[model samples]
Target: MSEPWTLHPDRALPADPTVRGIAREVYAATRDLSIVSMHGHVPVEWFAQDSSFGDPAQLFVVPDHYLTRMLVSQGETLPRLGVGSTETEAVEQDPREIWRRFCAGWQHFRGTPTRYWLEHAFVEIFGVTQRPSAATADAIYDQVAARIESPEFRPRALLDTFRIEVIATTDPAWASLEDHTRLAKDGYGDRVLPTFRPDPLLHVDRTTWREEIDLLGRAADVEIGSYETYLAALRVQRQRFVEAGARATDHGHLAADTTPLDDLEARRVFDAALAGAVTAAEAEAFSGHMLFQMAAMSTEDGLVMQLHPGVLRNHATAPFAAFGPDKGYDIPVVTEFTRSLRPILDAFGHHPAFRMIAFTVDEDVYSRELAPLAGVYPALRLGAPWWFLDAPDAMRRFRESATETAGFSNMSGFVDDTRAFCSIPARHDLARRVDAGYLARLVAEHRLDLDEATETAVDLAYRLPLAAYPAPR
Candidate 1:
């Protein structure tokens, strides 16, 4: 059996002591940098309520698609983990059993960052001293449960303790952001912010789309009938989010494609899309037009726009039918960002206020498309390699391929991008370690100096995210 370790020097530091010294120093320089989260799917209400967390299984397994997907991939049932409905229907009240099963299979995660992050979370958050297993599950659970019930473990306390300078949560555009507004009204700290994501507005065929669009119109106080009126309503909502303390807008699309259309043709296409009978060509055209308009709106309103395109959502139809949207079944299909994004880039690639962060399901395009695109365009920056590829190995691959072309400045710093709240510290710590390791390799090979590595590491861990996203006014 591979022995459990907290943080072995050999794993993250360079093998050679000289280079490892440099690595250790670089890690130290950035280790305490305040977290600046500009994009993520964490529930906004967490900050609104500022409640205490539950036990480990509910905190880790129930909310994270990353964790649940791995378990499901290994023939472990999601319901057994108490994530979705299927595993919960027959058996009831087995949170401890779920944690026990996860603990027993914890060895399956050996050497994976999930194991590292979970171990780190255990030590740092709950003060657990041993490896997780069926034998240790109940003890760890009771300990963590006790801590989470304490005032120090409440979400707000943890946020302050973690030294998170600013954290942004994604909310659907139709959402009133009343939670965020309420937080502001109560004179809570400005560290919690909202991101306006317009993904639901992208899929017109869903029954929920029309209702949501109408709700957005109501929120923005505009008519929803014509193309012009609909655009005005969306503009109004964007401004409202800004006034309510939004500094960014998020777009989750099937692709990064965008376009600008002439007035009549755009109106006709919009009419078709609004009626929910859009042809494939019309759907693409309308979405493309909306992307361009959203870019223009960003210029007008100063909200940084983020384009996280190319996810094949809910890849398993059966599970989707059985449970719901995010049950860990969504898979990344290969995506194209070159031709797909050419339309938008051709128009606003150099615009000053139209900032963008592009993510991909396709790592193959990192050098050929995204890096080159980000290298030249003042408006564009690369989002961290995401979803399945957010693993340590994949992160290293991203640095090796993209940094040569795009350089570190053209990349946004890491976003935990997690729904599981407790995992935030664990995830960010993993990124820092992984990034330091990558820099150590450069120093070992004589490609860069230790000072350059130190500055780059600090930027990657903290400062760059603030610079890339809007920083207040």
Candidate 2:
């Protein structure tokens, strides 16, 4: 009978009868609140063109690094899973075969957030009633393929069905944002916005730095002959993004250091980097200086600054050379934010116009560093548990660790931070359930009234994100 595949109405609620009842009520109050995905990596072209997604494998397996990485860990090759290669001669696998491999390895995803999200998509989105396995793989695939062919499964229609009020896509600083402009013309402008991501430009040690600089210059219509012109070009690009409805700037540095450098030293390092003579230490110092500069720019422009630090990207070199970045080998490192961010905090921590949300994969810092820092700094807020920590238990640990000091208001509401467009609603729903369980416990213990928990649930699910990353007027 395949265990009778079904989504329990109270799947993530507390097990205790009283707490589960309280959680059910809490969830019902906020379950329908429109999603505010203030930060994510979904490509804007899908929505701009209202593109119909392809088969099940193409829609779910190929673009999601989470699924691909897990399958790779189980000894399945990326190419077999339909992951495209950078090399020109690689062969593409059949979609059905790729999906079969995924389904055959489905048990590997048990107790994983990927499983939760996939199951949600299978049942709620595609109306699948059988558990995915080698036996059910083809049938499930055919069912989803049929559903995807419908007009209701189109990208724009799915967004509407998901009740997504506003979503932001991470875009390069040098991007033309033509897709976003087209969305605006297509009357979906206010619903989808861009977020400025300038990590490549910040790290001068990269071999592609020079080429990226030239592209930035072309994009901003400014000549970048010196450090002054480079900053000018970046400023112009940020203004362009602002005009296109960007409300936030996203930085993904390997560390959270934000020390500033004197202009003379900065210009010297910039010149060396341009000459391809920069050393590792110099590049790190310059990147830190740029982060401080970004804060200053945020203060002037009123765009919320987001820092997601301490990720060691591309842990393996072979896959990177064969494929490309974001192939799911990024690992987390221990992060210390208190002293590292003192320089920026001292400068703009209290600035009214400057708002910064900090995200991390390191849980040790949740209460020890981030919560305390956000607790005192008026300009700082703690971003939701992200990346590897977006799972249910980790989300609960985040609330237990950070809520006492930072409170619900100092936390940015759940940000999906996904490239998989179909996983947005699932991810948000999981967060809402986890939060409801947390709040329900408080009510069960008589620590909070039901009314207060209901309001907080709605705020965490919807209102906080809009306030944290307001749309540019």
Candidate 3:
């Protein structure tokens, strides 16, 4: 029988004798550093309730799009994996069946980051000694389920176990933030913070735009009559987020365009959108204009702006119609940052109070446009490899591509951008190991001293995230 699955001590390190030795030394310094997840999609309710994850399938299979998407590609249906059922499809109700399907397809995740993260979580978090397979699925589930029932596996308790110094949850602009308020009173306000995400509000062409606008108006306690009042209401909501310990604003638009329209044009579009008569071109223009407006707000409010563009969200209409968004149908397109972001960069690139981190699913832009732009812009730092590019080889390629021009300081370190709470530490661990391997290459080439590489590794893992997204004052 094959040996039980276990994480290798030097899993992601270089294989060359001298470089591998150097990587081991670099990894040691950052192996246990406190995680600073400045940006992610982890639900606030998890920490608010301090609840136990229901079971292995619920925790690992149901909510993780990364896991679900891979399974769907292999001809597995969504309902079988416990994804929400629709009228046309009946969802899987038995947790054991979902776990069995996941284990049977474990080989699909081979050579993927999901596999690395799962292995890490199994070996490190749950102390699972056996590999996931059809034969071992039930046994491993029993082992994990037994441990999860313990008090130590509770959401709040796992924060200490995961060594999460600070984690930020993405919140809609219209969110009440009552849970955040409760968390603040419970003394976890700073540890678990909120990030303002205004995507729905900014995209006027969405079918639910007017309803979202009303929700925003109610949340901010502002009566919206015109575009000016709408902006004011948004400002009020941003201030609310700030007071709730938010340090950053997250924007995931399809493009990086930041061109602002004239006052009259903006007013016209707002009125048209309110009346349900706005054109697609006008809606697109307004969203780009709002990005410029958001950059202005960031300058005034001291909230860092995180822009990750170039995703064509919900590429498959059938699944999207059935399951809704974030079911892993987002596809990357070629994005031109140099021309598209000039308006915002020219406006706030040198501003003292403004800060922005640019992330891209388009890795082709890393060396060509993003690195050069980030190298000189005082307000901008190129974000770490995001979404599809967050894998090990992709991360190594990111360092190779972005470091030449942007250097280490101009990079946003590692932002896991995950929604899976239990996978947080594993995701961060992968990034650190990848960075150590990259820095070891630099040290091996004599471009950086061993001491410099070691210190740089720590900064990438810890200091840079804090500096880029400072705690809200």
Candidate 4:
């Protein structure tokens, strides 16, 4: 209100000057800290291909489910957000128009995490001094569009500008890690590495299951026709990810269940699934068994495990078939982590080498399930808020709920699981501001000293993620 487009005084904190001052100091200390992104859904090809980004919408809106979900919530629809529909010809295929629609519905994101992120993007990246709305859409768009074309906004340059020390990209078992190889050879060092995500191989319900399984068999030189060989192939792939500088494996399951089964029963289930003679329940059970097996392997190899459950992925089968997965249709469901993860915990929860990070869409589990688990288990660490829960509000909720039990040390810090390279800075900046705000409150309430609060902020922003999911030396 005071200026054409000034950032909110408390954009990342409460609107109290005293608290804001302390937050600013805490944020400053951690602003330039090394970014260690331990998890994300980014395609490995971007780094592998080492290509420049295309356009504004393609780089930002098209790939981000957050933007599309909000647009759809306001009734703009995904097709208008560049989501390809069955009858793609009849859709509003114009990016400019889509951008305008996005600009018009900007109010929907107000007071939400998205708005804070977008405003940081507008101000810090594009040098925009105005909010995104009908009055300034074209101007805002053009400014950002022009800057992205400049040499400074190039991917590698942006990576440097953003102070990114290390970034992990999720790769399926089949990936060759050629880009990661290139990055290291090009003296990029440990800046960009691969994270092994075995979801495609784990979820037997996927249509590409057989093909991926076959590919895994060939990659591992094993007869994956049997369940024994399938597990062997996974071990081989784990080694490959480790060699490529990965110290973590990510599993996105329907639930956190881990059922440890013996040879005969496991073989029977796998054979049934492989031969298409299995029921849905059998496949789920087999998947659960494999989770424990994976953890056992993790104990052997020292690869940290991250389980992000409670997403009913692509619930609308028709939309998934037409538009592909992660198109803003997936919704969070209530999950039971304590009951689901019991079998695995019973087996390897005491193992010194096995480290597991718990991520949940079910916020209710934070106090009831996550905290108590992380509090007691030396092998377990609370994963940073992920997927639908990675916003400022969600981060705040997590800190308030989990800190009492898990504390700052028991949790991994921020992870910029993003594909839009420009958004990297914007996202991390928002996290720092929010963390600073949180710390400032503790200081204001006389619950913490400024020095200790500042130290915790730095750890939350930098050191914790590094220690939680360190890349192999």
The numbered model that scores best in TM-score is 3
TM-score of each: 0.94, 0.98, 0.99, 0.94
lDDT of 2 at 246: 95
Residue-wise C-alpha lDDT for candidate 3, range 264-310, written one tens digit per residue: 99999999999889999999999999999999999888899999899
How far residue 69's Cα lies from its native spot in candidate 4, in Å, is 1.4
lDDT of 2 by residue, 1-473 (tens): 44658899998778999999999999999999999999999988889888688888989998898998999899987778888654544645689999999999999999999999999989998889998999999999999999999989898988789999989999999999999999999888889999999999999999889999999999999999999999999999999999999999999999999999999999999999999999999999999999999999998888899999999999988777777898748899999899889999999999988999999999999999999999999999999998999999999999999999999899899999998988999999999999999999999889899999999999999989999997554
Q: Write the per-residue lDDT of candidate 1 for residues 1-473, one digit (tens) a residue.
A: 55543556545555677777777887888788888877777788878898866666778777777777777777887667775566436432577788788887787887676776787788877788777888888888888778878888877787788787788898888788889887888765377888888877765655577888888888888878988898888888888788778888888787677767888988887688776677877777677678888888887888888887778778887677766778737767677888877776777777776788888868899998899999998989998877777778888889998999999999988987777677777778778877888887788788988889988999999988888887435
Model 2: pairs clashing at backbone N, Cα or C within 3 Å: none
Name model 4 segments beyond 4 Å from true.
Answer: 1-3, 88-93
Which scores greater on TM-score, model 2 or model 4? 2
Q: Give the deviation of candidate 3 from the true structure as CA RMSD.
A: 1.0
lDDT of 4 by residue, 153-218 (tens): 666676677777778888888777787888788776477778888888876766788999888887
Alpha-carbon RMSD, candidate 2: 1.3
